[model samples]
Every structure is written in structure tokens, then in C-alpha cells.
Target chain A: MIHVQGLRKEFGPNTVLDGINLDVAPGEVVAVVGPSGTGKSTLLRCLNYLEAPTAGTIEIDGLALTAGQETRKQIYAMRQKSTMIFQNFCLFQNKNVLENITLAMEVVQHIPKERAVDQAREILRQIGLLDKQDSYPSTLSGGQQQRVAIGRAMALHTKVMLFDEPTSALDPCLVGEVLSVIQQISQEHNTTMLIVTHEMQFAHDIANRILFLEGGSIVESGAPDEFFYSPKTERAKQFLQYYSMKRYQ
Target chain B: MNFDLSYAIRQFPTILSYTGMTLRIAIVAMVFSVLFSLIITIVRYYRIPVLTPVVNLYIDLFRGTPLLVQLFFIYYGLAQLFPIFVNLSGYAATVIGMTLNTSSYMTEDMRGALESVPRGQVEAGLSVGMTDLQVMRHVILPQAARVAMPVMGNEFISLVKNSSMAFTLGVREIMAEASLLGTSSSNYFECYLDAFIVYFVLSKIITILQNAVERYLNRRGGAVR
Candidate 1:
């Protein structure tokens, strides 16, 4: 389980996340949807201390961290419980696909090289990237690179996986492949996931719950059906109307 | 007084004799300079408190001054100022001067390469739970080295050629030997031309080796762009 209380992130005087609170049950898939600059990415990044929360308390699998008061030990402990998949498929450009997956396992987790390679190979096979094990990320397409990124996160077996607009950088033709991989991972693993995405239809399909965030606050939160079909707030309805209009066009 | 091709050709053996010494100074200076550059780059990268400004000033002072002046200062001026420096060998002083000058430039090259690696890469490494040091060693530096290879190669070639300046300190390297042979034989043009050929060939060899290393790195799937 993951619990966040009063999560607030401020970049100087501008606050990105304002007193946001949410809880995610283990194995739950929650999609954070909002317009750009609404703090969707900031919210996810804060959970893992990637963008340190200005004020908040995050409790993940028994490790608790208070904002402005995290020690190195606590930060690392929190980081170990969560891993992130970036929008741009931030694969280490210098490493091949196989080395990318094994790097953290060998260096951070202290797994033996042979065992790490075996684990990486298994994940690659799972993501259908076995053939690209030796290929550099630059050579791989965006979709394939994101799958490799997914495989990298999975290898860590974190309690929570954060996706920051995973499909945002992919071409229209390539988006489906990466989305399917994330969908499959969400179904198979008991890892709790917080995905910030603009792929409305995919979010509706995969997310057990939906969070409608606006102006650094959750405007509405409910099951997908309720959140999509009968939004409680006018802002969410307006946001959905724009999304539907854009999708139809 | 006619130009004598045979005399120039004959000067090859004498010039070649000192090739080893010239190469020795350049290689030794290159090794130490590169090491020192890495230290400076890393210190600057982290902006280590008081030491950061000191390193900046060091780079500026070394880079701002001419190499010849630096060599003279270390070889002659320093000897006058300190008794220990009076015993410093000409070879040592020359190497020290070259290393100090080259390392300042190398530091800037390395720092640029390190910065060229996108910030996203560092974020990705951290997101996966790798420590800051691990990310630097495993992800950042490898990629930075790839980007900085050609520049570093250029620095090395410059170092090799700049070592000719060591002749002023009487290190007896290629240029020094050529000067001696030219003055003694009164055939300045031929001996100097021979020295030029040696320097050119050495530089060409360094370039070839550099390209070969780049090819090898590229073959190993170096990052694109």
C-alpha cells in the first residue's frame, strides 16, 4: 500500500502540488489525468522523491518519509520501493538494451553479474525485446525503448511503478505497443502503479480508478465508470469534454 | 649553398634518435595531464565548496598565460625563488609546464562532454535507485568519455606538438637535437626540415590511433549523437 498526505511541491514561489492526498491499494492501477502544467507529472515525481515534495508525508510499504526531513537512508529506502518510467524513454545511451536492464541490478541491488543478466534476459523476453538485447537504445524505436524502460523498472520489483506520460513521446503508430506492454504489466504484477497519461481511452481501459487533477489538486477521484461517465466537478466535465472533442477530431 | 636533399635525408637518423625523448615527454605529460584534468572536472562538476573557486582560478591562470612563459617560470624563475626548484631537471620542468597547460584545456573539454549528457539520463539512473556516485561512474562518465574522445585526441596531438617548446629548456628532444645539429653543421634548413617531418609523422600516427579508438568505440555501440 502507498499513502501520501498533504503532498505539496513548490518551485520557488509557484506551487505545483498543493496539499494533495491519496492512497493506492496494492495492485491497484490509478491513472492521473489532467491538462498540461496541472502538476500531474510533479505529483508522480514527488512520490519517489524525484521532485522532492516541499511538504508531505509519504508512507510506502512501512517506510515513511516526511517532507523537508528525509535522510539519505530514508530517501534511498523510499526510492528502492518505487521506480519510474520516463516519458522520453531515458535509456542510458551508452549501454545496450541488456546492459541497461542489468545496470541497476548489479550495481544497486548487489545481484551478481550472471544473475543480473539472466534476470534482464527474462524481463526482455517478457517484453518481447529478446532480439534487441544487444541493440543500443538509439537504434531501437521509441516504442521498443519504452518497453526496455518498462523491463528495467520491472527488474527492480518495486512496490510502486510511476509512469510520467509514458506514451507522450511515442509516435501515433508506436503508442499502442508501449501501452499494451504497460497494460500487460499492470495485469500481471501486483505492483501498484500511478500512471500520468493523456491517453484517455487507454487510461479508461486499464485504470481501476481515475484521478482528475486540476490546479494542483484532485478535482475528482472515483472508479473509471463514474469518473468518465458522470464527473462530479464542472472542471472535470469541461476537461473531459475537451478530451472527447479532441479525440473525435 | 644550394639546397641539398641528401643532407636533409641524412639528418633523419639524428632527428629520429631524439624522437623517443620527445615522445616520452609528451606521453608522460599526457598521462598526468589527463588524470589531473579528470580530477579538476570532477571537482568542478560537484562545485566542491571552497575548492571549486580555487580550481577555476587555477585553470584561468594556467590558460591565460603563454606556455613558453609558464615553462620559463617553472625552469628559471622558480629555481631563483626556491632552492628545491634549482635542482629540478629540465625534463621535469618541461613536463610539468606542458601538463599544467594541457590539463586546463582538457578540463574544459571534459566538463563540456559531461554536460552534453542530457539531464534526463541522470534522472533515469536515480529513478532506478542507483546512488549518485554509481550513476556518475556507470552512466555519466562512460557517455561523456565517448563524446569527449575526438576533443581529447585533439588535445593530445596539440600536446605532442607543443612539446617542441621544451627545446627552450634544453631538454634535448627532437627540436633541441635538430637545433644542435643545424647549428653545428651550419645546415639549419635541412636539419629543421627533418625535425618538421618527424613531428608531422608523429602527429599523423596519433591521429590514426585516435580514429582507430573512435571506430572501436563506435563498433561497441557508442551513443548516437
Candidate 2:
């Protein structure tokens, strides 16, 4: 479960997230879609304190961080509750894939090594990368690397999974494999998810709710069908029209 | 007379006597330089407010001044300027000078290596619930070490060569011993040749060791471009 109240973020003289309030029920999958330079990524990052909110409160899985008063320990605990998947796959280059999946569990969470490996083996089996466990990330394709990244996030058992353009960095051909894995995970587990992505079709397919963000605020919000077909704001309508025109042509 | 092989061979034993002293200075300086520079790199990488600028000042000051001048100042100038350094031995000054000088170059190499790690890697570590220190330890440092290995290898060889400057401060290293032997025996060619051969052999040894360390660091990461 996640609750955000009056979230705001500023970079220098510019305001990025403007006094936004949101609530997500447990197991809800919310996809934030926005044109470039909008605060989709920033909003997701602020929830993790990756970019600290200039003001507001982020409460995830029973841990709440009010902007000004949160300590480092509190921030790390919150990070534990909501792990993130990055576009770049960011696997530790020094570790092979299995070590990548087990590192956070052993080091940060202090799960015993044998237990961590067993859990990693299960995740590797689920992701269908059990054979590639000994391979370093650079040896794998971008899609394979991203799958290992998903395995890393899955191993943590986090309550809220944040995906920031998970498929944006993949080759067009490789994107499907990763999307299917994410879809499968969303169905298998009831973890609440917020994905910031440009894949309109994938968002519609996977997300229960669509949040159309423009100019640093959610201009329109609804179920995927209603939001895609009948947007409330002119900007969102234009945005959808642009996306459609761009897609077809 | 001119480059007498037997004369040079005789001077080898004499030059070899001071090899231990030279190694002592190089090893101490290398260890301290490595420790100091790593700390500086971490401080600058994190941009720890007050300390960042202070270390930047240190790097700039040490790097800008010629190492010879720095050594001369430490051996000769500091005593005049500060009472605390009045009796600082030449041996102590030589170690201090080499450590300070080498660490400046090392800190830059380390900082560059750390920066070469993609920003996303650090964020990934953090998002997985690791603390800042854990991210540095498990993700950043190992990657940075691999990136730093080649250049740091150069620094070690240079540190060995740089230890020659210790002679100017009156520490009896290889160069100093050779000079003393040449002036007394007036066998300058033989004495200097002995020193040259030792330095050449030592650098070769360091290069081999460096290649071995690089292979170790690269063992896991040979595939990265």
C-alpha cells in the first residue's frame, strides 16, 4: 500500500512536482505516462527518496517519511519496503548474475548466504535464467540483463515495486520478454506497483489505473480504457493524439 | 674507465646494500599514499561539504607544486617556519614528501575511476535497500578498483622512481648511495650505471606485478568495454 500527500519537488528555480496527492491500494498497478521533461521519473524517485521531496510525505508499506524530518535509517528502511527496477539493468559488473540476485539479501537484509542462494535459485528458475546464473551481465543481452534485474527486485520481496521505464533501454525485439516477465510477476504476487513508462499499449495492458502526467502534475487519471479513450484534459488528449499519430506514422 | 663492466658489477653490491632502505621508503609511501588518496576520493565523490573543498585544495596544492620543491620545503623550509618541525629527520621528511606528492596524483585517478561507474549502478544499489556505505563497498569500490588498476600501476612505478628524490633530503636510497660511491671513488660511470640497472629491473618487476593485479581485478569484468 502507498499513500502520498502534497508531494512537491524542485530543482534550482524550476518546480518539477507540484503539490501532488495520491493514494494506491495494495496490489494496484498504476502506470504514469507523460511526455518528456514531465515529472514521471521524479515523482517515482521522490517516493523512494532517490530525489528527496522538497516537501510532502511518502508512506509505503507502513513506513512514512515526512520530507524534512526523515533520518537516513528511516530512508533505508523505506527503501527496503519499495525496491526499484531501473532502465539500465545496473547489475553489479563485478558479480555474476546469481551474485547480483543474492547481494542485497545477504549484505543489506542479512539473509544467510545459503538461504539467499536458495532464494536466488528459485528466482532464477522463475525468470528462466538458471543457466545464465554464472554469466556476467555484459555477456548477456540487454533483455537478459534486464531479466536479471527483475530477479534482483523479486528476491527482495518488496511490497511496492517501482519500475522506471523498465523496457525503455531494450532493443525493440527484446522488450517483449521483459514485459511478459513483469506482467507475470504482477499477476503472481499482489505487490503494489508504479511504473513510469512510455509504452502506452503495455501500460494499458498491465496497469489497473493510468495517470497522465503533464507539466509536473497528474492532469488526468482513470482506468486504462477510460483514460486512453476519453481523456479529461486538452493536454492529455493532445498527448494521446500525438502518441497515436507517432505510432501509426 | 669508460663503462667498465667489472667496476659496475662491484658497485652493484654497494648499491644493493641501500636497496632495503629504498624499498622501505617506497613501501611506506605507497601504502600511505593509497590510504590517503582513497579517503580523499570518497570525500570528493560524496561532495561532503566542508571536506570536499579542503581535499580539493590539498590535491591542487600538491599537484601544482613541483615535487622537488615540496620535498625541499619539507626537509629545509618547514623547520624554519614551524618550531614543531625543527628536528624532523631527513628520513621522516622524505616519507612525508613522497606520500603527499603521490597521493595527489592517486586521488585524481581514483576520482576518475569512481566517476566512470555509471550513475545508475549506484542508484540500483541504493534502491535495493543497501546503505550508502554498502553501495560503495559492494558496487562502486570494486568497479572503481578495476578501472583504476592500469593508471595506478603507473603511479607505483613512478613512486619507485620518485623515491630517488629522497636523496636530495639526505636519505641514503639507491640514487643517494650511488652518488656517494661515485664521488668518493670517482668511478661516476660505474656507480651511475649500477643505479640505472637497479631502477630498470625494479620497474620491470613492478610492471609484472601490476599486470598480475590487473588480471585479478579484471577476472570478473573482462567483458566490459
Candidate with maximal DockQ: 1
Interface RMSD, one decimal, each candidate: 1.3, 1.3
User: In model 2, what lDDT does residue B162 have?
Assistant: 87
- Whole-structure CA lDDT of model 2: 0.90
How big is the positional error of residue B29 in model 1, measured in Å on the Cα after superposition?
A: 1.2
Q: Write the per-residue lDDT of candidate 1 for residues A21-57, one digit (tens) a residue.
A: 9999999999999999999999888887788899989
lDDT for position A64 in model 2? 91
Mark the regions of model 2 whose C-alpha exceeds 4 Å error after superposition: B1-3, B76-89, B223-225
Top model number, TM-score: 1
TM-score of chain B of each: 0.96, 0.94
- TM-scores of all models? 0.97, 0.93
Q: Write the per-residue lDDT of candidate 2 for residues A1-249, one digit (tens) a residue.
A: 899999999999999999889999999999999898889999989887788899999999889999989999999888888888887888888889999999999998899999999999999999999999998888999999999999999999988999999999999999999999999999999989999998889999999999988888889889998988898889888999999998722
Query: Model 1 TM-score?
Result: 0.97
Residue A64 lDDT (model 1) = 86
